[model samples]
Target: MKIKKAFRRVGMFSLFVAAFLVTITSISNVSFADVRDWVDYEPMRITNTVTNTVTESKFRQSSLEKKELNYLEQKKMYISSDEIEGPKTLEEAANINQYPKSQVVATGYTAGVESTGKSPGHPEYGITYSGVQVKRDLYSTIAADLDVYPIGTILFIPDYGYGVVADKGSAITGNKIDLFFNTVEDVYAQWGKKELDVHLIELGDGTLTEKELKQLNETDSLQVFRQQITES
Candidate 1:
């Protein structure tokens, strides 16, 4: 009878140990499943965040480009009509002839390389006779006969654009003008003795009276000229 009782207790203990091991395994499986779910979800959340950031950046860049384009369009609209067309009326012609002595139909020449040692305002080659510095721009400076277009006179050429009479040359007498060039090659290549329609924009001292200034400001043809003079 005692042997049978001992066998029964051993069986009960083995069954209890088996149930405890099964419970431990179930808890471990639940924890591992939660960890797997979190691992899978984390990558998708990170991808969504990155996509949102890139989308916002692209939107801001597009907005900036549109703003810049609008600004450029507005600037184009402000360009004056006179720039597209020449002087129109007889009154316009008369106003332009204010400096009649300075205006002329002349031939153009190039200097710089033709000059000798220690010129007046230009010490490098000493090309200019008037002692005024010749500007480096292709159409901004010219040499003329002082008797015809005096120093400080501003001239407007139909094809060549605007220039200031800042220098003189012996060959540039009468109705002849010389356009300065940086190089002898450039001088020979671009200009020779070509007839030019020169308008005297201003004469010596170049001062504007209140009435003249007001008239220029009111006129559309002189808008660009007015702006240029005022800025200068």
Candidate 2:
């Protein structure tokens, strides 16, 4: 009877140990499966060249004052009017060759230079110029639009239809982007800015010779960088 009791206890203990070990193995397997997708995501480098220009034109002023009464207001009210019927400046409309101090419009934002077609001769035509004058400082903006890149990435923008994030903006906090148009006509030309996916080529790789960057700049195109290739 004593031998039988001892045998029964030993059998029970062995069963318990096997069950505990199986439970631990199961837990370990689950943890590994959950983290399987998080391994080996390499960062990519990207670059794009932009050709930009700004044009400044003067606009006419209205004969109105702040805090002036409107037509039907019972009491005095603040009035602000748009300065229409003239250009923004008396200087040359398109000054591409000359370099003058540019006015800062909005900082930490993206800006562009384009034609309004509202010039007295052509009231409905315009195009983006490589270089123009502006009354305000242009800003370049980049945020969390692309899936690969992060916020606050500084991208160099040159002109129309091309831009990279030189700096990110709060408004552009997602996969969204804001492109600057020089005039209202150009803004409406495409019925507002369109969202599109972009491929960013990386830059700053040591493998790229200095000659490559110079060649790219001479062509007026930006250089991109790729990962290092091990020479076996």
Candidate 3:
């Protein structure tokens, strides 16, 4: 009986070792590319190219992040109305050559009725004025003045990576541009308005209508699709 027990123990130990080896082997077999899609979420820090003169990347203001917002109401209550300015800038609207690069006022937004007046599941929920679907992370989109940037103008914003002007907004004319976010909360938190550096890579062809040229040229799809989202 003792001999039998000892043999059973040896067999079980062997099985455990075999299983451990298999797991390590499987893990080693996983190619880096297989997991890079997820690992890339962290903002990249690199120098040389003209994304940000500061040489930093902002993690795409995630649209997938979900956090409790009950605390936000209390935060909002304390905000002095004196600090709140209307969405559009006080500067007079003028066309400027945004080609190659320029500074633009950047604001973040989400794809909700509050921003686009179209709820999720609406026919045009995540669609841009250019009619392309807007995506987050690396595929993030932007809204700018089409007259300046046009329908397919591509831009590289500091911290933010390359984003195509896929939509436009009324208040987005001139040097002002609106960025897409997952939630209105992110708009206020991650990217409240600011004048940021922009590197214009290429200008899109003027659509059926027109294109005079300059800053905040790309149109945002949400703004293009929803004419009724902004508040007075």
Candidate 4:
């Protein structure tokens, strides 16, 4: 009788564990692709499992029922857009920038052997250290020392656009950072290497989630941050 009761309890516990795991899987896999269909709407941001940026999209403002939208706008949840057209000089970058600006050695990287010491044919060739797939998207992917920059640091370069720290390079340490380029030639002829002042939009908490973004919205300049990235 005792053994039978024990078996039944164990079975129930196993079922509970399975259900929890399934629920977690579903939540982490949520994608924003469906949001592309929305028309006649306002801008909003969402979170991904890895690195996330405050991306703007057109959606029916009424969809939020005025809660999230109101909070976002009333609280001024975006960064400053004054960085658009980029700062012609470090002085200009620091002057118009809303965040704490600093200087760092910046270089361009490719997903090839010359930059990553990995062949292009490799399966993980373009994957960032933080598991983000590197792409030429609205914002650029940046590589730096994870110890120094964490995983989601956003740096706005003068005369350049915004770059998010999603990868790490073995040689990148201290205050040095690397910007991603689609091709090696672009790295050499275009970006190469230079020292520039960068504005620290927000320092990621070594984790990606909606919580971190919300925290930034509360205290940082997220309104202009969106315009700088999208418009510039």
Candidate 5:
């Protein structure tokens, strides 16, 4: 009976040990499955988070760059306006002319007159000597001394706006400019002599050389002017 009892106790102890081992193995398998799931899922979550952060950062940078570019453009426009103010004296005018033709500025008196479209009775009449038609519209015409402002030269007159050197006259000499009007009444009424600022935007073809032509071709103003002419 003593031996049998000892045997039964030993058997019970072995069973308990086996049950504990099985429980440990099951726990290990569950832990490994959980690790595998984390390995499979966590990298994608991390990659998505990083991608969103980079995209947001790029968007912010682009917005800031646009604002900076706009500010620079506004600043350039302001500076250009200040630079175009007319020079006061003949010496000043000469000095400005020494610079690039595109940058020349002249301040002078302007007189307006009507075109009769006749002959020897009116020396300044009808079609321009340069072959350009005489029109009273904006920037369409102006009578200037060819020696001073050649035909095809573009001028920006304050209050009067833009005009081209399309015609010439004996009395329209030096810094004096003659603005053409369609009717004598309109000339007498609104086209009185006045001191004005003039900005020489571009020199005429007669004044530019081949080298100068190459240079003028690269200018933004000339390009824009040509484009305007083409469009018109």
Candidate 6:
């Protein structure tokens, strides 16, 4: 009778142990799932870096919302005005001359390259690094009004495509739109100062998203930093 009772107690203890282990495993899995969800839901930070010069074209015309009375015999009514010639220098760019309503905003940075060193191809000069050539994030510059446009702001320049303002440059100051060219030859190919009307759209704070963060790992800038790390 005592042996049978001992057997029953042993069986009960075994079942209790098994249940305890199952409960522990379930709790661990739930904890892991919570961590996984948090990681997946992480927010993205994007930052845009651009140059300090913006080009405004007076040639652009505003479209009429609605036109009344289309007279076929009258040859229609459209006001065609001459281009407003403006100054090209930074000192002259700040003046709200042509677009009277358009506000003047300062953005900094001229051109950026993969790094501070390295020469890019210039057709006339061969491979040179005298003038800046932006290989990455070329169009959008950091806005001077950090209050209005905080860091990590994304800017869209329809003329220059899309660019992120990751960092700021010293030379980029004031209302400027710096053009990025892969090579010096490309810059010269465009010829003397051309007039361009750029469309600027603000993207979010230009913070580095997880996807962009991955890109930095493989970029040349990372290699440079690695070399510095070893040297230091």
Best by lDDT: 4
Report the lDDT tens digits of candidate 2 across residue range 76-192: 665555434332321222132242222212212213323232353442222112221211112222333334234323223223212323223344444454454344554465325
10 residues in a row with least lDDT, candidate 4: 64-73
Local distance difference test, per candidate? Answer: 0.54, 0.33, 0.63, 0.67, 0.54, 0.38
Q: Write the per-residue lDDT of candidate 4 for residues 56-78, one digit (tens) a residue.
A: 64355454333231122366567
Using TM-score as the measure, name the better of candidate 3 and candidate 5: 3
Per-residue lDDT, model 4, residue 203, is 78
Q: Give the 10-residue window scoring lowest on summed lDDT in candidate 1.
A: 63-72
lDDT of 6 by residue, 1-232 (tens): 9999999999999999989866765654434344454455433333434655445432211111122333336566665554344433321332323322222333222232432233345342212122212233322222233333344444443323334444443443444333344444544553223334433344345244434534533565234333322222
TM-score of 5: 0.38
TM-score of each: 0.40, 0.24, 0.45, 0.49, 0.38, 0.28
Measured on C-alpha atoms, candidate 1 has an lDDT of 0.54
Assess candidate 3 and give its lDDT: 0.63
User: What TM value does model 6 have?
Assistant: 0.28
- Can you tell me which runs of candidate 6 are displaced by over 4 Å? 1-152, 191-197, 213-232
Q: Candidate 3: RMSD over Cα atoms?
A: 28.6
Ranked by TM-score, the better of candidates 2 and 6 is 6
Instruction: Give one digit per residue, the lDDT tens place, for model 3 in 1-232.
Output: 9999999999999999989866754655533343453466666666766654545455442422321223223544665776663333211111123445788888887789987889988998987787766655432578999888887776766545456677888788998888887778767866688897787877778431222222232435223322222221
Candidate 5 lDDT by residue in tens digits, 1-232: 9999999999999999989866754654434344455455432222356556422224433433343211223544355755776644322333433333232222222232324336544554455666555654435467777887887787765544456777677667777787755556555566566765667777776432333323434555334344332222
Candidate 2's TM-score: 0.24
